[model samples]
Target chain A: MKALEQKILTDGIVLSDTILKVDTFLNHQMDPLLMKQIGEEFAARFQHKEITKVLTIESSGIAPAIMAALQLEVPMIFARKRKSLTLQDGLLTSNVYSFTKQEETEISVAKKFLTEDDHILIIDDFLANGQAALGLLHIVEQAGATAAGIGIVIEKAFQDGGERLRERGIQVESLARIESLQDGKVQFVKETRRVEV
Target chain B: MKALEQKILTDGIVLSDTILKVDTFLNHQMDPLLMKQIGEEFAARFQHKEITKVLTIESSGIAPAIMAALQLEVPMIFARKRKSLTLQDGLLTSNVYSFTKQEETEISVAKKFLTEDDHILIIDDFLANGQAALGLLHIVEQAGATAAGIGIVIEKAFQDGGERLRERGIQVESLARIESLQDGKVQFVKETRRVEV
Candidate 1:
């Protein structure tokens, strides 16, 4: 988490009060070494839970999900943003509203991939409004699977998404939580719940 | 290579004459162990080349690209399908025609991520019509970067993509090459060239 926090402070750019661009090392351009460490941290944190699968949305989430899956030694299922012709007809779909794109889009996972016997850990690059995480949670619920935990690289703590999920008693863990991004400066939450080193 | 070839024969679904779905292990639902082996295989194959960075498209390609980057201990850069508001204005963009979607979409990478001194190895899940690879190659050209090699998980030999790249003298290494998928039976082309195991 320290490494991730450091990377965010060093390489991440605060485009505006709401948007933080981490294309250099987090999403668009990935740092495999850092991802490995983050993956290890997730595995260490959730090793006690029975995580059968790592679920994530397309594009940004794929890298960290893959790393976490490798660390957990479990299968990773990515929900495609667009329905591909190759995808099967039976699917677990959920509507996601993208604050960045300002569009409502559907994300889905093939029903065949997830099942009631599985415990899924959701992972993603960023959690702002939590629409993406909520959509993934919906899909997991539709499959009758248990939500073991949620792992995120960064969380906009000033936003209500993290608080909302916590209000529902869902276990959410983010590597770095931004307290506020005022005046083009990223502020980290002064206090956080204890996590395993 | 034998491991990958065997995985294809066992788990790969021959969807149609031209479509072979390896989503069970390669894409949508990913097997991390197999992906590790794939990364090892790619590292073995491209060991002689100077690969500064591993390049791939988003979604499907992210896993293998990250795995390969882990093996190579290099940075990985993925081209995003759409430009988000967070993305910088300066980028290397290319138009890619999707066979499945039947549309042309633009892919872009931040200009700072890629450089003329970088030796990029392009990796992808499938090379059907090779449009995606072509688009990635174009991005590399736009960055003035040299492509060290191209590693593909599966290449549809019946399609013109692989031939087109080879015709252009790009070093392409496909783990499994399918000759045809007639009657839902996947047929692999005989391994004519030596592959690092």
Candidate 2:
């Protein structure tokens, strides 16, 4: 978590007051070594949970999710942002709102992957509005599976996504929690609260 | 590679004569253990190349790319299907025609990641029409980087993508090469030809 926070401060670009882009390390251009460490961190946090599968959205979340799946020794399922030609008809679909894009998109997962017996852990790169997490949770619910927990690499604490999900009693664990990113300076939540999750 | 072929034969759903769905393990619902093996195979194949970075397109390609990067101990970069809110303005963009989606989408990568000094090896989930590979090659060219090789998980030999890229003098190593899928009976190109490339 410290490595991630420090990397964010060093390599991450703050395009605007609200947007913290860690694409250099986490998303667009991925540091696989760092990713493995981050994944291990998530695995360590959710060590007690009996995770049958890890769920995520396509694109950015795939790397961390895959890494976490590696550490957790579980299979990972990424929800397709759009239905492709290869994907079949029977799917668990949910509408997710992207705060950055300000548009709602229907994300779907193949129904065969998730089942009632599965204990699913939702993972993603960024947790801004929690819309994507909610969508994944919806798909997990649709499959009648248990939502064991949610693991996020970076969560904007100033945003209500983390708070709202926590208030909902969902066990959300994030490696880097951004307290504020105002006036081009990034601020993080104190490290003392890292173990409370 | 044999394991990948075996997985395809066992879990792959042949939707039609031309379409082979490998979402069960290779893409959608990814088996991390298998992915790691596939990644190691790629790394072993490209062991000679001094690859500074690994590249791929987002969504389905991210997992294999990440795995290969892990094996190679290098950073991986995924070209965005659409420029997200986090991505910047100075991007290397390419127009890729998706046969699956039946549409042309602009894929972009951050210019900062790819450089003239870098040696790039492109990784992808599938090599069908070679449009995505061509697009990625174009980005590498734009960066003035050396395209060391291409590593594909599955190459449909029936399609022109693999042939075209190989004809262009690019090194392409595919784990599984399907020669024919006529009448739902999958036929390989023969395992003897695996070592030629």
Candidate 3:
């Protein structure tokens, strides 16, 4: 988390008070070194739980989810986002509203992937509105699977998504929680200790 | 490769003559252990090359790219597919036509992530028409970077993607090459030897 926060300070570009673009190292372009470490952190955090699988959304979330799945020694299932929903046979689908994109998208997973016997750990790159996570949760619930906890790389604490999930008594752990991004500067909810380069 | 071939034989579903869905393991619900092996195989194949980075497209390509990057000990960059083209100053963008989806999507990477000195190895889940790889190759060319080679998990030999890349003198290594999928039965280009289960 210290490395992540420091990387955010050095490489993360704050485009606005509400937008932080980590395309340099997090989302579009990823640092596998940091991603592997992030996965280890999640594995350590949920070491006590019975995590049968790691669930995430497509595109951005797959990076960290793959790393976490490697550390946890579990398979990962990513729900694919569809522009339009059609059939209802083998797919377990849910509709999610993206606050950043300001659009609604449908996400789905094959019903065969999840079952009542599985315990899932949800992982994502950013948790601003928590819509993606909630959608994944819906898929997990539809399969009668249990969600052990949620692991997020960065959480916009200023947003109500993380708080909303916590209010529901869902265990959520974000590696780095941003209190705000005002004045084109990122402020974390908890200050990080000085780290050696 | 044998393991991968065996996996394909067991889990891969032939949705049609042209479409073989491995979402149960390769894409949607991923098997990390198999993916790790696939990555190791990619590393072994390209071990002689100086691969500074691993390049891939977003969504399905992220999983194998992550594994190959982890095995190669390099950074991985996934070109995000955007429905629209925005500012192109800080990005290297290309338009790719998806034969499956029958649409044109814009894919881009931050200009800073790729450089002239970088040697990139392209990784993807499936090579159908090779449009995605070609788009990525264009990005590498735009960056003045050299493509070391390409590593594909599965190749639809019936399609011209692999043949096209080879015709262009691009090095391509596919884990499993399918001869055809007739009558819902999959056949490999090269017969795999008997393996220990």
| Better model by lDDT: candidate 1 vs candidate 3 | 1
Docking quality class, candidate 1: high
Most TM-score-accurate candidate: 2
Per-residue lDDT tens digits for candidate 2, residues A50-145, read: 998999998889988988999999999999998887775899999999988878999999999999999999999998888999899999999999
TM-score for predicted model 3 compared with the true structure: 0.92
Q: Every model's DockQ, to 2 decimals?
A: 0.86, 0.85, 0.56
lDDT (tens digit, per residue) of candidate 3 on A90-194: 889899998677688989888988999998999999999889988988888999999888999999989988877777767888999999999999999865421
**Segments of candidate 3 deviating more than 4 angstroms:** A83-88, A191-197, B83-89, B191-197
> Which lDDT tens digits does candidate 1 get at residues A118-182?
99999998998999999999999999999998998899998998876766777899989998888
* Per-residue error (Å), model 1, residue A88: 4.3
> Given candidate 2, what's the lDDT at residue B17?
77
List model 3 lDDT by residue over B88-144, tens digit each.
468898999988887888898888889999999999999989999999999999999
Q: Please give, for residues B1-197, the per-residue lDDT of candidate 1 as tens digits.
A: 77888888899888778778888888889998888888888988888898999999988999999989989999999998878777749989999999888889999989988899999999998988999999999999999999889999888889999988887877899988889999999888887453433
Model 2 interface CAPRI class: high
Better of 2 and 3 by lDDT: 2
Q: What is the DockQ of candidate 1?
A: 0.86
Error of 1 at B80 (Å): 1.2
Best by DockQ: 1
| Better model by TM-score: candidate 1 vs candidate 3 | 1
In Å, what is the interface RMSD of model 2? 1.1
